[model samples]
Target: MFNPSQFHETVQRINTKVPDVQHKASQIDIASVKLANEWFIPEPVARLIIWLKDELIKLVEELMNMMTQVMEGIEAPITMWEDAYKWETVRGIATSVAADVNPSSLGSTGQWTGDAATAYTNAIGPQSTAAAQLATIADSTASSLRSCAEAGLAFYIAVALVVAQFIAAEITAAAGDASVVAAPAGLAAGLAAAATAVGVFVGLVAAIGTLIGTEASQVSTLHGLAVDSTAFPSGRWPVATNI
Candidate 1:
């Protein structure tokens, strides 16, 4: 069985192998801690990973925060939807209800994404279970995607830290392999191999819903709204949901 727990197990396996992973040669001599293709890494790239980890942490933090705001903005259209609904009842449905977005809190940085759009649409589309439950569905869809993005950021940050730590351990154990300049390449190869054996989440996290290819489709109401009212240019379905 392809266990979902493979991700964690592979990370554990990675810590074991990178300083000692399945190498390019293709051997599995784990008894001796040496395999046919197992290899070591170079000093420079290994150090680079450390530096990269530090830098990535800062950048990813900013990304995570920014994305959070964008999802929040996805809900901005709800007010517009409600106001229009009220106007519709009062005016006998004679005027086109308008949608709006306000970025008073997270600055002008928050914007929608393709995933946000798809989520909103899936909830409100005629075929959706949420069409009649727009208020709840809109919030839930934005919240789900926002949460997914946060999870991805956390995953990468953790991966960066783990990668740096494990690779450092590999470097310490490489004292006897100073004669091998091919170690770094081998280390990279080993990481790639482990990543393969692990899963796609090993590299970069895919877009929201991309892991299983389940992004949302457009409905009539969602087709014309702005994807990003603040920064991201995702979808207008959030606005549509309020109505």
Candidate 2:
């Protein structure tokens, strides 16, 4: 389950990582500047440097934008579910109530059947069953909320992985041998390959209930979960014991 507390900690770590990535991007820019001043760089090599630098910075900017949506649409809702709704607490209370009026707790010893005991059992039996049903509902609702949070986290992770792939490609191109002029073409190819893999993986994640997807059905699912709260009204039916 995706605990809101753990997600908060994970988001803090991700926040720290953003600054580190920004710093690395700045260093890349500085290195490119120094190389331009010192070396007899060919046109192709200089263009490659500029292209890779721009692409890296673009990925970082996109990541930041995605983080905003993640916090608003994903983390916020999960936190609300954890704090405001308190489904797990409700489940605990219901479970305890369901178990409290059992034969053992009601002082019904072995073969000790009396009028009072029978009357108590008759009164409590349906209530216990109803409480158990409510407990199950609460547990499932909590699980669903966690699943939504996890789905959003997965999309955010997919974006981060794409950024990492770009960084790796940039570093490789900058540090390679004399055939570095061909780096731009290789990097473009690398970008296409990385996009393909991430696209497929993200598509699967969206299919399994996530916020990232290109298809219509997946997008609809994302909208329903993240945006359309009215579509999923909680506690629609009144609570009542099975009579």
Candidate 3:
């Protein structure tokens, strides 16, 4: 019952929405790279920047694929429900006949008799269980996608800060070069400045890494909450048929 056309449409919808988020994140990465370049970082840092950008692009593609699968999983149950509902209608009619033919028999116990009861039970119980399981799968998939995205972002941020530090070091080196023509006392000052810059850069990098780790922790928590919120109760299962 799952229409291929509908699945394709849903995948297209997800793909269309993902680009906007990826673009925004990419812009942030570009800005960071520009800032690093302005500070005169070494060539190695620029290479690293390029690597980070490529990784981010890959993450975006993976996210789109994961989302498409999730969307398809979500759609599958609806199609199954539609088919189940049609079958339930026939079951309902048979139940009515069974009830009329055997008033005292358990088979005549209203709609609970015959195929109607079995169909209803299957729809409300097993079908709902399957949906919940699918939701869990989707949730897990989304979580993995988010993890990859966050890791890529964190790597970018760390590399940017390191590049900034390298740039600062280069500036210190330039100052040291100038001090050679100034005074002997200026030599010590230049050395001290470079050391201070290195220390500050190391500390900043450590702090940023810690922050990124914290953000990653929240990703799983958020995903679990999303799954719990979306989990539907079995009672809400649509009537498979009429009685």
Itemize residue pairs with steric clashes in candidate 2.
Answer: none
The candidate maximizing lDDT is: 2
Report the lDDT tens digits of candidate 3 across residue range 1-243: 334454445445544544554454455355435633645545665555444444444544544454344334444333433444454454455345434333344342455757766655554443344344444444444444444433433433443343344334333333433332322223234334434544554564466457557755865764554445334333243343555
lDDT of 2 by residue, 1-243 (tens): 455665565566656555665575566566655554446777667776567656655655654564455445545545634642588898899899889955556665446679765666666765566566667666766665655556655554554555455455445434432244554554455445434544554464456443322322443443444332232225232223334
Q: Rank the candidates by TM-score, best first.
A: 2, 3, 1
Candidate 3 segments exceeding 4 Å error: 1-113, 116-120, 140-155, 178-197, 204-243
Question: What are the Cα lDDT values of the candidates?
Answer: 0.36, 0.55, 0.44
Q: What TM-score do all the candidates reach, one by one? A: 0.26, 0.52, 0.32
Q: Which 10-residue span in candidate 3 carries the lowest summed lDDT?
A: 179-188
The alpha-carbon deviation from the true structure for residue 205 of candidate 3, after best TM-score superposition, in angstroms, is 5.0
Displacement of residue 102 (Cα, Å) in model 2 is: 8.0
lDDT of 2 at 171: 52
